[model samples]
Target: MACRSCRRQLALLMRQTTTATEFQNVAILRQFVATRPPRLDQRRNFGSTPRQLGVRDIIAQVFKNSAEPYRVVQATEHIYKACAREASYTISAKDRTAGTIPKTAEGEDLGEGTTMWHNEFKLPPTFSTWSQVTMLHMYLIFARLRDLDREVARSWQRQLIDHYFFDAEEKMDLVHGISSRGLRHRYLKDLFIQWRGIIAAYDEGVVKGDSVLASAVWRNVYKARDDVDVRALAAIVSWMRLCLKMLDQIPDESLYFQTESVFKWPAKNEFMLVDKPVRELEDALQPTVTSAPAKAPVKVAAKATA
Candidate 1:
């Protein structure tokens, strides 16, 4: 919201200082979300290691490269579509997350797509839920896009996020029935702010540890619910680690050629990402106090005080 045009477009900035901050008090987390993450956090990338670029990544800049601007647009569109679908695909009928979708008849395994998110994790299938899920998927891709050269990566990032806004605004009009463009813009601006928080929180988690990442997922997707299952959060962190590992193996040119086909999620009953480790290291998930045994004063009380 620095410039009027930026406010209108809901354009996200890497750094921002709100006009409201000048007058009203703002929380420190809000300011943290607006700025870049610390350099140490960038260096501490753990589960999501930076990919080593191949010839394709390096040669993407050549004039002879086949990925023209138009093709990149198409690729980004596919990515956006895939992510939007995946966001809602796992919502089991039992949770009533889908507004118009019919309920399951006994044991049908199909609704839209298959996963254990809604039923097992107890998340709703509402628009807010869908957007939060979509943001996670978007982050997976964003992490990968950062591996390419700077200008090219920035272009792709902008295109991918612009596609998200287009889809999100359409949903506000069609699904939620918000007719006012101005109102939708306001909502989108709020969503952009949330997206900033996601980038910061998730990045810090990847560099730090699963516990940290779990907290990020909890606060963002779970709405900081008191009753959220710890296992569910661990599963999600494991899933993201798996996604980044797989994404790291692909060449950068693959995303430019076709993004949707490259991005993959676990199908129904196929989650093998080892969330058990999170449980085994239970101490990591919560704080513990250790009581130290007292040593007798000074010389082990060998010589009693007079």
Candidate 2:
């Protein structure tokens, strides 16, 4: 009998082997036969592609040093994975990639080793007011843990807040409200603040270099308002304000801010107008932040939880 055939028989016999020494020999032979030969012996060629991981992509995955915990860390990771899977289908559907892994500038296969969320919503169709709102809340939590560009984060945040208000009102069908007049004016007033803040952020260079957030926010905003009624828009803005308040109340120690920092005072002078409203909202929404034994800011920073 051939050596290979003999080995197979031995392996089969080992399964039923009752004698200890015989079983041991059979098992050893079976392992030898089943073991894969080295690549040179197999004579097969192999290659792998490489790419650069973006700063945002890395930050998105890391939850260490965050004021928040790992559960929120897990959620961000889950979202990224979900988005990545969606990106694969969407990119293929749009013919952006030809049934292969996409790469960033560094030639590393961009989507392969990374989480899904970054790739999937990198562009529209996946982008929406709801997504923007959800992500901003995540971002705010993250911001408290890290030092990011305060103005840029704030500008995008303001836009997302405005968008959610209008969106929430429309969803609830509370456009006319129980009192139609009170609804419209306050809603409109909030919308005006959001719109003007976003515009002013652009004018004042708050979003000067934040192309990614700026472009995405504006695209979603425009998509939400193609020939829609002015009142519908105002209602959307009001609804968004309520969401912003809720999001603001999300504890800094929550999992979402694991590696991020919430903007206490983003931008030098940008807070001048928004501070009052932010303070009022915060007073209503934020829990009393217990003092931590009056430690120095550096000392506080040192033992801070993520």
Candidate 3:
């Protein structure tokens, strides 16, 4: 009987010890959980959540926000077309025949007199001259876009070049009377090669500074003529740098939509040339901001020497 009683006591003691041990283990686990640092919820949620919108995203959002892919493409095409038209307009001959020509004190035909181009740059009114000027403006925009997302830049550059060639082909048909598609295509192919060469040359010039840039302008745009005016070369180089700086200041969002107005050329006065050397043009192209000097604090007089 005593042996059986002792056996029961031993079994009861063992059960109690097991229960206590289990309770202590659970307590320890709870403490460990409570003291543990919070899990990185942000990291945990990263894969599930969408990324913040970037410039490219904002551009893509245009398509989504419109909900029509065709409309988005049409709008983009129209925008680029308008930009190309504006660029071409810079060199388009003004309708000098629209109004009566102004007479000087001497009854000379003012229209027959030397014009700005004749008086200053002496650039002839030729298709090549107009095309060069147009390309200059286009190149400025291209330079500004170099830092954009690769795909975005590629899309814009392709569209812009398309608009340019379209205009060029149309002009060839209408103005030059090259109605043969084969001939126009050949001309355009040549111009595309020229365009690529100009980009490479101009990029090199920009890296090397104003003198190198002027040399490129003379070579490509002026046809490397020995008689090319140094002053005109300097002026064009100055204008390019100025336009690039202006475009750089504009935000990417603004550029995506309002490109035509944003990329407009500066006023004639803004490009006025001084008699300084070409090196000075670099300084002229840089952005300059002048601020008013801080006012000195006013001194207060003591109470009438009281």
Candidate number with greatest TM-score: 1
What's the C-alpha lDDT at position 23 in model 1? 23
- Steric overlap count per candidate: 0, 33, 0
RMSD of 3: 28.8
Best by lDDT: 1
> How do these models rank on lDDT, best leading?
1, 3, 2
Candidate with better lDDT, 1 vs 3 = 1
Model 1 TM-score, all chains together? 0.60
Scored by CA lDDT, what does every candidate get?
A: 0.68, 0.37, 0.61
Residue by residue across 190-270, what tens digits does model 3's lDDT show?
A: 988988888998999999999999999888767788898677777768767877777788788777565556545542323
Alpha carbon RMSD to native, model 1: 21.6
Indicate whether candidate 1 or candidate 2 has the larger lDDT.
Answer: 1
Give per-residue CA lDDT, model 1, range 149-256, as digits (tens).
Answer: 886677678778887887788767755557899999999999999999999999999999999999999999898989987767877887788788887887887875
Please give the lDDT score for candidate 2: 0.37
Candidate 1: list runs displaced more than 4 Å: 1-67, 89-115, 257-263, 267-306
Q: What ranges in model 2 sit over 4 Å off?
A: 1-72, 78-220, 223-226, 255-306
| Candidate 2 residue lDDT tens string, 1-306 | 566435533443342233233444455557555655455455444442111223333343332213122232244444333322322222232233253545444442232212122322223222233344343343333333233346424432333333344333442233112246566567556655654545444333323443333433444443433444333333323333333344455654452432222222222223244356767888899787887687555543557678
